[model samples]
Target: MAFLSFGSKRDKIKKMIEEEKFDEILKMAVKDKKALQALIELLDDSNPGIVGDALLLLSNVLEINPNSTRSHITPELFQKLMALMERKNPYVRENAMLLSYKIIKSFPEVASQHRDWIVEGVRRGLTEGNKDQKGFLLMVIGELGLKELRPMVEELVSVEDKVILPFEGKKWVPLGDIAKEVLEKLS
Candidate 1:
């Protein structure tokens, strides 16, 4: 059956994602590792829009059923995701940060094994100019409860500026306040 051909579903899922068919992609991906693999493969897509669409689809699948979603995220997939945080496309980087946070939060044991990589991402996010990305990374750092990073996050508390945090609605929050909140949770 053509429908059951190897890589056909993954290819179809990839095409659907590129076409912005998120609802269908979500339906196809929720419990299917091949669908998940398609999303992962799209992370390296040259088109940022396609990559963003794939990331958003993965995020939706994770939110729908984190247990099943996390089970499909093997180490190689995890590494690929982590590497996207530094992608040149701001949209891709931001979405990757959000998805990475969800994955780490839902799969702590797996994330723990990638501590150095996470820390590297945090370090880059903090040092970078994108406040929105910084905000997302702060959430991950807080969830991680890395005491060693307290000082790094603590440094942001004195800055009297707001960042567009991707929370309920990409709310503008004081960077210092968000950092303070993360520090409080860490302590």
Candidate 2:
């Protein structure tokens, strides 16, 4: 078993991610809080490439070790992610929202603590954000608004702007479907 040494964990983990060594990264990040912190720090780096890789790695890490990461959640981390959501980079925004969903699901306290603020922020994005952002915000809203389905349906059911979400290769997901799904959750 390879142990993750401290101090250089950021560069090492970034390399491992670049090399597509997800299994190793997951093991080390799940076991070492320092490794997790390094990944989190990457989110603040000036390099968008590093930030994207860090977001991907952090989301995957949270999935693999949710129990170990409850203590890692903080208002600052959430604030950074929320800021990332407002950025123009599609990868950055999607991963940030996805990671937020993962963390909220793992710790109900996150949902209770931040759901209203997050939902409202995303709702605001629906009108003010760009195309890609509107789609991501709607998807995140779908996941977060389950308990307030009636209000969510009332507010989002008429949004037919239809953001195009392209997937790998020729695939794509329609944002309208997401809106429909959110309404369905209300039923």
Candidate 3:
């Protein structure tokens, strides 16, 4: 009984993912607040690989069952995600932003209710120098489809920091130009 209460199942989920047992992982996570909490806790693990895998699984689970997943998506969770998006690790930050976007996209009603929080989160994610994350933020902004982001989008209009992003294999493109393209799409 003590083992059952104190044991971790994250390793199992990771293993299942390794074995391509997505159905099993989904069965373990979907509509299960406890499992969701466990997955969230896994995000804090020191291993970036573990954290990335957990984020991917969580995103998949939430996408499949947003209505049920909503119970676990509180204001605190969103705030924590905002912080995660600023992580030094680009891979982790990318996964975090992707998961955050999935949550907001799946539940537009929640974003509508918490417009201020979501907008602030978006602003906070738009840091300079992180070309990849800034691009991810742009994609999230597009997914959000919120006109309230106009001010934040305008803030990028004058940014001259050039971040070379890979395109078509060998072609590296500047982020400043991409920002202009995204701004045009927003308009």
Candidate 4:
């Protein structure tokens, strides 16, 4: 469907998400560039159903078209999502974390320029955030291979709870095993 002609505006937006039409939604999302603002509004909708879908849609769009949404990853979005990490809603925090992770992966140079904010965000999420959120952070850290984050990963290992690496089809394997194997070879 044409980005602009998707149908009743709201339904069209929802349909774009449901159909995983990242390209189309992204095109629409950048048109006027206000769609990003609209998507941000849905992030706080009281309706959990709408909020969850919105977050997922935002995350997916950002992941698929990082360049299109790069501008949306302003300091405001960073601060807002980091604040949402403390919210009672796991879904919100999880999606927010994933969005942050994707942004870091897609734009490592930009992320490096804002290392302090990214590090602080991950630190808070690692300490006070939910288990799932912690897992996401660990995965991001591992993917980035940032030696600077080694201390955080080391600290995580001391906990009785193990952080598992997410694998294909959502299965998880012990992160400790992965780390140990890598460390042994490095040493």
Candidate 5:
């Protein structure tokens, strides 16, 4: 019976994703362990959209309850996230980075174990990422005080391109301004 419910739970979560009922999923994750587990399991789903939704949902869960969320991140799950960071789908990659940043903040030990990968991701994001991605990577470095990335970040200070910051409305801000801001916060 319990085994049967797991499939139903996963199916329900998939339906929610398909319907774009993210708030409902967040509420369920916060209130029901089964729902949360279903979301975690969905992270393994092959569909990039489902994986991206799972990553966003997990990151939101981490934000709401860092302690409880930390327990869900096993070594294997973390490795899966690392792989997702390299995914060609921008949504998946961005959410993977966001989740990784949140995880690094909440679970220092797990992050320290994967520090090299995290730093490399930042390096790659700066080079290959679009405006949003580059901005987020800078935020991660600044918030985490990853001073080792100072030189690489410094090189971006001269870039003149502006990025649309979603949380900051429709205004476009210079990427170099963001880089400068991160540099200031690095120490």
Candidate 6:
């Protein structure tokens, strides 16, 4: 009953992406906007492979030009991404978490306005996230210089293996390094 063939749809989308047609891709991504909604809907497909492909496509497009993506990333999109952080698929969750970091880094002012949400997400990741996720989260926290989060960092420091020791092997890298940097700047 459909006029456009499935292969044609696939080829068209792939060609748009390969051509770096970001605006086209974005327009399709928005619901009820264009044929691209099919691709966006695939993001929640029951098939893991389909979902993975959609997430990768979305992430790639956003990363291609974060500033351009900012306008399209409405509050609704943020909430959707935040919810995806708890997805059963680790890959999906990890990508969603990383995307959150990218968004924050790209727009610090907007992120600052949602500081509490960001902090909560980081806290959850640090507490229950797998090692890879924790390491990335630690790096983000360090970069963000959230001194007020020292108490949480301190608790992590209390754990033996969680400490990232200097590669020179001469001294252990204090978890406080991040908090210290933040406090110093504030003082």
lDDT (Cα atoms) of all candidates against the true structure? 0.77, 0.70, 0.70, 0.62, 0.79, 0.57
Candidate 2 Cα deviation (angstroms), residue 111: 1.4
lDDT of 4 by residue, 58-167 (tens): 77667556777777766677777777656666666666666766777787777676767777777777778755556666665665555566776776554444443223
Candidate 5 residue spans exceeding 4 A from truth? 1-9, 19-24, 31-34, 44-49, 74-98, 169-171
Model 3, residue pairs in steric clash: none
Between the candidate structures 1 and 3, which one is better when assessed by lDDT? Answer: 1
Model 3 misplaced stretches (Cα beyond 4 Å): 1-23, 127-129, 146-148, 155-185
lDDT, candidate 3, 1-187, per-residue tens:
3445556666666667567776777777985666767788778788777787778788888878877688777788788777776677766776787788778778878877777877776676675526565666665676666567767667765666555322232125455555566677777
| Better-scoring candidate (TM-score), 3 or 6 | 3
Give the TM-score (vs. native) of candidate 5.
0.72
Q: What TM-score, over all chains together, does every model reach?
A: 0.83, 0.75, 0.72, 0.67, 0.72, 0.57
In candidate 2, what are the lDDT values of residues 1-187, reduced to their tens digit?
A: 9975546467777777678787787788899888888889889877777788788888888878787777779878977887887767778876786787677667766766876676676666666776556666655655565455345445655665656453332125555566667666545
Poorest 10 consecutive residues of model 6 by lDDT? 162-171
Order the candidates by lDDT, highest first.
Answer: 5, 1, 2, 3, 4, 6
C-alpha positional error of residue 77 in candidate 6 after TM-score superposition, expressed in Å: 3.2
Candidate 6 residue pairs in backbone clash: none
Name the runs in model 6 displaced over 4 angstroms. 1-42, 158-187
Which digits, one per residue and each the tens of the lDDT, describe model 6 over residues 45-129? 5655555555666666556656545555555566666666657776676666666666767777776766677678778877786
lDDT of 2: 0.70
Query: Ten consecutive residues with minimal summed lDDT in candidate 3?
Result: 164-173
Candidates 1 and 4, the one with greater lDDT: 1
- Candidate 5 lDDT tens digits, 1-187: 3445534488899899999999999988877778888888888898999999999998998888776676677767766776776677878887887787678778888767767777886787778877767876787788777789999889889888887543343237788888898888985
